[model samples]
Target: MKRIGQAMKRMTVLLLAAALTLDPLAAASRQEKALAETKAQLLSHIAVLASDDFEGREPGTDGESKTLRYIGKQFFDLGLVSGTNDPGHPWFAPVTVLGREPATSRATFSRKGKRVFVLQQDVLVYTSGKRALVENAPLVFVGTGKTIPSRADLAGRVALLLEAGIDGSDRQTALIQAGAAGVLTVLDGDHTLENVAGHRQRLGYALGGEELGGDLDAFIAGKALDAALAGTKLSVKALQDRAAAPDFAPLAVDLAVSLEATTRETKIHTHNFIAKLPGKRPAQGAVLLMAHWDHFGTCAQPPAEHLICNGAIDNASGVAVMIEVARRLAKSPQLDRDVYFVATTAEELGLLGAKAFAENPPIPLSRFVAAFNIDSVAIGPAGQAFSIVGQGLTPLDADIAAVAKQQKKKLLMDNRAEAFVRRQDGWELLQHDVPAVMVTSSWGDVTRVEAFLENDYHRPSDVVSPRLELGAAAEDVDFLTALVRWFADPRRVPYRSAAKPG
Candidate 1:
């Protein structure tokens, strides 16, 4: 009997050792398979979306139709619930886009009834709608124009402001609220008025009719500014230096500005693709994933090399990651809270889809745990750090750091946070008090983004090439998956707030 018991114990020990050795191997194999599958899907989706036939995947065009249908079908196939509130299993949220093209754009600035600025050279003007006209409005140099000064009242006056950091603050909103008639911002960066001339020609659109106010938002160069302040007590350079100081005063410059612009109006329709995976626990709140799928449409002026702006990196990469992540999560065990994936539209236009979604969400705003935006990603290799674009805007940095550590990668704040954080669709949700963050590879390695923008940011050359690698994008998918998993965990519900980092 003792010999029999010893033999059984030996057999049990051997079996336990075998299980331990094989379990890790099996897990490694499964992980590799999942990564391989996701990578393959990412490449395939980019190929299809970036094809020239899609006409650049522009909003409110044939490209939009094809793109939305493909995304909806993929989400449906992945078994995710429809993101819409409609009774049927519809995945689209129709958004109306009112596009206005500049017909006759003009901005003329004068000092004491003498013209000192040249249109498209010294100054450029843009309107919110079809036409904007402000004649002989007194221009008051309001420094940063961020807050209403105690002694200064800019009622019915044009506020001349030095360009401020783009930290998601709406300067125009503040200026308008301060009773300013219009705003004329001086170009402060390395860019000149000529550099921004091309932007005034792009199609401008708004989400709702009321959102497009009849305000003049114009850009002026240093040359015109110098001419305006030529004989004034405060020189342009001196005033700019003083404005940078902490104790700055609002100055009323000795100049008045005039603007007249007209745009041809066009009405179009766009769609936001949404899919949700309901969780077991409802109180944990839902996790939102966002990626803009729209790009520059069929170029009115097609380039010679490639007629279409195949935005392989601008967003096809992001949508592919979102789809792959959704597929994997759909098959995984039930999460503690719901996960929502939104493929926003008109992001190229002006974050119209995101604005619409924020304005009318499928669920209550308070139920959203956190919002994550994935834009133009992976232009580099894996193992590199990931940047949180709106790092200080929310407390999600802790969550991002934790995920990065688990992936054996690094976490850093976006170096150009002020410039990019509010530029993406995430900004719309952030404005509505949703804790949103944009994760990208461009945060730390500014060169990667600069290279992309210089070569193919919004041009026809943006087509997928050997230079555009997917290693970093693949890693980001894993990082985002981990974040969602954490957010969905009932025991790990995140604290939602809009506290800026000190």
Candidate 2:
């Protein structure tokens, strides 16, 4: 009996040694298998979402209905409950959107009670409402519109801004906040007035109840400004040169501008798909994952062989990544804080849905531990470095860096991707002091991203194909899974004040 016992112990020891030797290899195999499955899943989701039948997933269309059903079904199948917490529409949160297009617009300029004779074609006037009128508001040249002159009482006055690569939305918002009755952007860059007019002629959308008031937003041709200032000391060229000075201040142009714009408004109803994985400690802060699911529908007119902008890489890939990450997290052990998933609507239309959600959140915005946004995440190949779009703006960078290190992924520490921060859904949340970031390997390769943007982005050519590089996107899914786990752990990432990071 003693001899038999010794032989059995030796056999057990050998088995233990063999198991130890193969564990690393086994783990590696499992990881590779998971990655392959993630890639396949990503492709499957993108194929369905980017299919011609989805009609580019435009909001408030038959395409949007189909998209909502598909995304809701996916969340339901994953055993996630409604994050919106509305029992009547458990899986969806309603977002009312208003679409407006300029029908008729005209602007007139006067100097010393004499008509300046500015051509109507030289200026494009637009409003966020049905009608807007700005009568005889004096024009004050505010240089680049980056700063309002303290001495210049801009109340009820028009602020003329030199277009010097400044963001139009930010410049307009700044001037509006400073009590400017109207804003006019002069076209001084590569973009011609015709190009600007062509782009703005289309229907613009914003969330309901958030429309612009009687304030005027107009763009003027530089020549028109020069014509209005003709025989005066200030010319467009002189004003442009003066704007280059560091101490440039607002200068009163001897012109009074009167403008009237009429818009045709239409109301579109859309919904944001929301699902949640309940955590053990419900009172703890939650982690949110978001991706916009809307794209331009029927972008091309008839006679074009392809008429739809499938948005395969623009956002189908992003939604797929979000879905897969949710799936993986749902299957893992319960997290301490809830993980919420939102597929927002009308992101292509100025992030209307995201704005609505922020304005009226299911949970208090302060309860959100961290938020990560994914967009156009299928451009780069595998092994590309990852970038945080909101890199230096938030305090979540250290935790994100830790996860990247653990995953053996290279993280670009530069804030170059911050240029796109205001262009995505995260910007809306960030405006509300929510900690939001977009971590993607695709944006790390600026060349590939730029090529995609210039060539296929928002065009009919953005379709699903074998050439859609999804390797890095799959890796991002894995990275996000790890990130959510890290953030959802109450013990690791404790709840902090939700103030915007300085």
Candidate 3:
């Protein structure tokens, strides 16, 4: 028994010595250090982009010049070829847009010859380029703003449209194409009058230079609209339900709308920066990654404090993720298909850069197998599932799911997918039949997304905060890096022949 006890003590001492020599915690320490370093790198870029020096990275400002230079320089240093065909320099594709601001606006809604609303309070004309002068134009309720039959005569009338879903832009375009003089969209969801007004006024746009416009577009608050339609033949709810149902006829409201607006237009030239890492088989197709680098610029109306609207999470985080992902892709072995990185400008200006790129792709649109647009990522906890916005828009969800599974993460379908789909740059590409997906980290606490939207969205308060977990963003970077790797593998083809454009 004494010998056995001594032998056991000796074995314990030997085991302790082996552990000391092996440095059992060394690998974990290295991993921790590497993670810390990556977080620092991501935060560094966010700090620079969201800093006052970038001036909110607004399009057509001096901030634009700085932003373009910064992105171009980074791409050049990365040894990426300019995807642009510029003779002098290849990184830039210029997109010209008109920035219009309303000088004076007036609108009135009357029911049965009784005035129901006055401009600047109950009604606001948010869009103005050319003067819109209409006196007592008859109101026609077009169901959900869908395309009207060509035979329908909509000349010299104002169309009351229900709020559309992901296809809102298409519906609005259809309304204009149907020869409606103007369109008034009802507010949707739990939005207040002041909130709606602020949301509308806060929006700035970069309208296509060649785009034709003569119609007025405005939004009416849901509550005020309800009050206006109380005594009418068509209640607001009935109109909404009718618009939603098929075989619904256009209801001629008991009201007419009068509108007038004056505006100032200025031209601004911004660009989308494109860079490419060539693949082993260039003809197969390319995987595209995109991120918008522009922010709100300086506040349109500066408050007493926080003059700059630093869009840290709004986009700087996204751009940083794009850069880091690009770095990883560049370092890896040659992918089966080329990878193109586009850092777009004027995204806040109604996705103008993306629209411009899709209209005239640096490479043929047919060669693009898929596109992943990175925006507003990982503001929540680490290891949360990826929220695939606009999940059913395309078959790309399968690839996202596969990637998520490989990364040991789950996929969270966005409940408000359409709202995000119509708003992001990816949707601009999707309209052209390109398989694109907008990805964000799942909000483990749903309030995180709501809080950001209610408080930080488009505000100066969007700057980086302690609440922003860089560790979560780092996890997103890893996931995206893995996604790109899996997406570009020669053995795998996510696109079916039916899905691929010839």
Among these predicted structures, which one has the highest TM-score? 2
Residue-wise lDDT of candidate 1 within 1-502, one digit each (tens)? 9999999999999999788668988777776777666667788999988888788998878888899888888988878889787765378887888878767757666778887655455666666666778887888777877666532467767888887532213885578667777778877777666555665676667875645657667777766677767777766688689787888777777787788777788887778888899889756578899999999865546346567888999899989888878877888899988899999998887788899899878877767878899888858775567788888887677877876777677777545645777788889999987889977553457678778879888888877777777877877787788888987875766434213311
- Candidate 2 CA-lDDT value: 0.88
Please, what are the lDDT tens digits per residue for candidate 2 over residues 28-125? 88778877888899999999999999999988899999889999889899999999888887889999898888788889999888888988988988
In order of appearance, the predictions have TM-scores of 0.74, 0.85, 0.74
Worst 10 residues of 1 by lDDT: 493-502
Model 3 lDDT-worst window of ten: 493-502
Error of 1 at 312 (Å): 1.0
Candidates in descending lDDT order: 2, 1, 3
Tens-digit lDDT string for candidate 3 (235-303): 778887887787888778888888776667778888888898888877777889999998887784645
Q: Relative to the true structure, how large is the alpha-carbon lDDT of every model?
A: 0.77, 0.88, 0.76
TM-score of 3: 0.74
| Evaluation by lDDT, superior candidate among 1 and 2 | 2
Q: What is the alpha-carbon lDDT for the whole of candidate 3?
A: 0.76
